[model samples]
Every structure is written in structure tokens, then in C-alpha cells.
Target chain A: MRSSVIIFPGSNCDRDMDVALKKFGFKNQMVWHNDQSIPKSDLIVLPGGFSYGDYLRCGSIASKSKIIKSVIDFANSGGLVLGICNGFQILTETGLLNGILQQNKFLNFICSNVYVKVKDKQNKYFKDLKKDLLELHIAHNEGNYFCSDDELKSLEDNSQIAVTYCGVDGTENEKTNPNGAIKNIAGIFNKNKNILGMMPHPERMIDKYLSGEDGSLFFKNILDNFK
Target chain B: MKIKVIVTLKNGVLDPQGKAIQQTLNGMNFGNVEDVRQGKYFEIEVKEKDEKKAKSLVDDMCKKLLANLVIEDYKIV
Candidate 1:
């Protein structure tokens, strides 16, 4: 399979995503934010980092970058696009996903391993995954997810909610809500399920010795589904 | 003409920075402080001499870039 990881000015995780994608048998290319066109690929990633110094708002500036137009077009065409961490923030800013990732409710940057329950497996991102919950790494200050009540209702009704924060036993509650995301939403899919935006960094957790293997499961599942 | 604008989080939206400032003020014994909210202020000097046109341009800027309509409200002052 082929993949492309878009690199914004300050994207710190693009290399890690490239490594992870290649490790999972994907031929991954790094695409710069200023480029007008992206190489044809099966998947495109907006990796984690403080793009544009998190200016104006996290991911707000990067969302308007030159390359984003192509990214949005790709998504509109039903191509698979994944946004991780700062990438997730950019997706929301671009209106590709619902809601805004506000600052954490506690007014602090949180960096830790979090358990995320896969809310639905109907999408290509998580379909056929063996586990209902995966432990992933979250590092951000603005990870609090907020949306209008009506939007939330629609998302729930459509099963657009892809993953939510939860405990290891798959229990979801306040204790597991690290950043005060609404309803513990850790990630979500667009109505078509071709686009996914999430706060966790699966690229950061692809190695068992360095971190954990849940990310490996995530990458492997996507490649298998594509094949 | 110079256009001035203020952008603030909409009512009912959580403002953690504002909350922290409120707590800090309370700790400093400013007990009368009911609540606090943070916002952004921008002043743009447009070459257009017409006040109405300048204000309209700034309004457009706010709607498109300065403020995210989903979570923030912008007012041309």
C-alpha cells in the first residue's frame, strides 16, 4: 500500500508516521505543506506537532496552508485521510471533522498513555481490529473536544464517533477523561467515515520496546483492510 | 481607517484560562469577582478611507480567520 504524510513547518511526528507506515508495509512519502499537489496514494496523514507555533489557535494556521486544499479535495473524493494529534486539530479547523479541540479543562498540557475504546468498527480505519480498546499516547494542551448539542446528537445517531477515552477494562467515565473532551471523545469520523481525526498519536506507540504495540495493531488493520 | 475587533468564546463554552485567572484573583482576595473570560482583540489599519468599508472588511476577516464561528464570537467595535 502507499501513503503520504504531510509535513507542516513544525510537524514533529511526520518522520515517526513515515517510519510506522513503512514498518506496516506501506510505501510512505513525505509531502511538504507548501506543495500544491500530493503524490497519488492510498492514505494521507496529518501528523502531530505544533504547526505554525500553534498560532491563532492550534492547527488553525496550518489548516489554511497551500497543501491543505489538495488534502481537502482528496477527502471530498472519499479518499482515506487520518489526522493525529495536531493533525486532528487541523482537520477540525478545516471543517473536515466536527467540533473544536479546546484547551484542556484543567489548564495544563497533558502527556500520557491513554486507553481508547473503539466505538465503531464499520470504518476502514478500525474495521476488523481484534481489540475493542487500544492504549495510545496523547500529548497536547488543547485536546478538549467541544461541539454543539445538535451536532453531537447527529454524530451519535450516525455512529460517527470512532473512539473514546476509556479505562483498560473498557469502562469510560470521568476518571479516564484526561483532557475533558466532550463525552470522552478521543477521535471521530466524518459522516462518510473516510476521514478520521483523533488526539492520540498512534505513530508514537508503534514499537513495543519503545512504547506499546496497540499502534501496530492500528496500522496493520488499515493495511489489511486496504489489501 | 482603523478597525477594532474583539473575539471571545461564546456563552456556555468552557474557558480554562479564564477560570485560572478567576481563581488567582480570588486567591488575591478580589472576592467580588463573579467570573472571568478571556478574549482576543485586533486592530487593523486598512487603506480605505470609508469607515463603513473598513469595518466591513474587518468583519469579513473576523468571520473567515480571526474567529471560529463554532466556538467564538467576533464583534467589530
Candidate 2:
């Protein structure tokens, strides 16, 4: 499979995504944010980092970058696009996903490993995955996801919610919520389920020694589904 | 002409920074403070000389880039 990881200015996790994608048998390419076009690929990733110094709201500026037009067009065509961490913020800013990621309810940057329950497996991203919950790393200040009540209802009704913060036992509640995101939403899919925007960094957890292997399962699962 | 605008989180949206500030103020003995909310202000110098045109341009900017309508409201001041 082929993948592309867009590198915005100050995108710290782009290389990590590149590594993760390649390690999982994907031929990956790094695309720059200023480029007007992207190479054809099966998957495109907006990786984590403080894009545009998180100015004017996190991911707000990067969402308007020259390359994002092509990204939006690719998404509109039903291509798979994944946004992780700061990338998730950019996706929401671009209107590709619902809601905005506001500052944490406690007013602090949170960096930790949290359990995320796969809310929907009908999509390519998490389909056929063995585990119902996965341990992933989340590092961000603005990870509290909020949306209008009507939008939330529509998402729930459509099974657009992809993941929710939870415990190892798959219990989702306030204690497992890291940033106070609405309904403990850690990630969501567009109505079509081709686009995924989530706060956790699966790329950061792909290694068994460094972090854990659940992220390995995530990457491998997507590649398998594509094949 | 310069267009001045204020962008604030929509009513009922949680504002953690504002809450922190409110708590700090209360700790400083500003006891009557019931609540606080944070917002952003922007001043844009538009090329249009007409006040109406300048305001309209800024309004578009707010909608497209300056403010996210999902969680924020922008007002021309």
C-alpha cells in the first residue's frame, strides 16, 4: 500500500508517521504543506505537532495552507485521510470533521497513555481489528472536543463516532476522560467514514519496546483492509 | 478603514482559561465574580474606504478564517 504524510512547518510527528507507515509495508512519501499538490496514494496523514505555532487557535492556520486544498479535494473523493493529534485539529478546522478541540477542561497540557474503545468497526480504519480497545498516546493542550448537540446526535445516529476514551476494561466515563472531550470522544469519522480525526497518536505507540503494540495492530489492520 | 472585531466562545461552551482566571481572581478576594469568559479581538485594516464595505469584508474574514462558527461568535465593534 502507499501513503503520504504531509509535513507542515513545525510538524514534529510527520517523520514518525512516515516511519510507522513504512514499517508496516507501506511505501510512504513526505509531502510538504506549501506544496500545491500531493502524490497519489492510498492514505494521507496529517500528523501531530504544533502547526503554525498553534497560533490563531491550534491547527487553524495550517488548515488554510496551500496544500490543504488538495487534501480537501482528496477527501471529497472518498479517499482515506487520517488526522492525528494536531492533524485532528486541522481536520476540524477544515470542516472535514465535526466539532472544535478546545483547551483541556483543567487548563493544562496532558501527555499520557490512555485506552480508547473502538466505537465503530464498520469502517476501513478499524474494521477486523481483534481488540475492542487500544492503548494510545495523547499529547496536547487543545484536545477537548466539542460540538453542537444536534451534530452530536447525528454523529451518534450515523455511527460516525470512531473511538472514545475509556479504561482497559472498555468502560468509558469521566475518570478515563483525559481532556474532557464531549462524550469522551477520542476520535470521529466523517459521515462517509473515509476520513478519521482523532487526538491520540498511534504513530507514537507503534513500537513494542518504546510504547506498545496496539498501535502496531492499528497500522497493520488498515494496511490489511486495503489489501 | 480599520475594522474591529471581537470573537468569543458561544454561550454554554466551556472556557477553561476563563475559568482559571475567574478562580485566580476569586483567590485574590474578588469574591463577587460569578463567571468569566475569554475572547479574542482583531483589528483589520481593509483596503475599502467605505465603512460598510470594510465591515462586510471583515465579516467575511471572520466567517472564513478569523473565527470558527462551530464554537465561536464574531462581532464587529
- Tell me the deviation in Å of residue A4 in model 2: 0.6
For residues B16-64, write the lDDT of model 2, one tens digit per residue.
8899999999999999998999999998988888999889889899999
Clashes of each: 0, 0
User: Cα lDDT of model 2 overall?
Assistant: 0.94
Off by over 4 Å in 1: none
lDDT of each: 0.95, 0.94
The TM-score values for the models, in the order shown, are 0.99, 0.99
Give every collision pair in model 2. Answer: none
> Runs in model 2 with CA error above 4 Å?
none
Q: Top model by DockQ, which number?
A: 2
lDDT of 1 at B25: 97
Q: What does DockQ give for each predicted structure? A: 0.89, 0.95
Candidate 1: docking tier: high
